[model samples]
Target: KEFLQWYIKEQGEEEENSEANVKNIKEAGDDLSAVDEKMGTRGG
Candidate 1:
């Protein structure tokens, strides 16, 4: 039960992070190449 609760919390955090990244990418618009380069270097 403890592991299940922890896993759910982690998943929620990951989802939020992913959504934020997507939003950032979308907002980058014409500068998407820069975003991709940054993410690639960060190994994200």
Candidate 2:
């Protein structure tokens, strides 16, 4: 029973971390897209 409790806690932490990572990736992607657009305009 103790092990199960610990496992559940670990899973919850992992899920939170995963969500944070996803949010960071999305923000990074938006920044990259903006940079790409500027580069495209300059190239043309």
Candidate 1 yields a Cα-based lDDT of 0.76
Model 1 lDDT tens row, 1-44: 99967766776689887677667767787488787889899996
Q: Quick one: RMSD of model 1?
A: 9.5
lDDT of 2 at 4: 65
Instruction: Give each model a TM-score.
Output: 0.36, 0.67
Candidate 2 collision pairs:
none
Clash tally, candidates in order = 0, 0
Point out where model 2 deviates above 4 Å.
1-13
- TM-score, candidate 2, is 0.67
Cα lDDT, model 2, residue 10:
73
| Each prediction's RMSD to truth | 9.5, 9.6
Best by TM-score: 2
lDDT agreement of model 2 with the native: 0.84
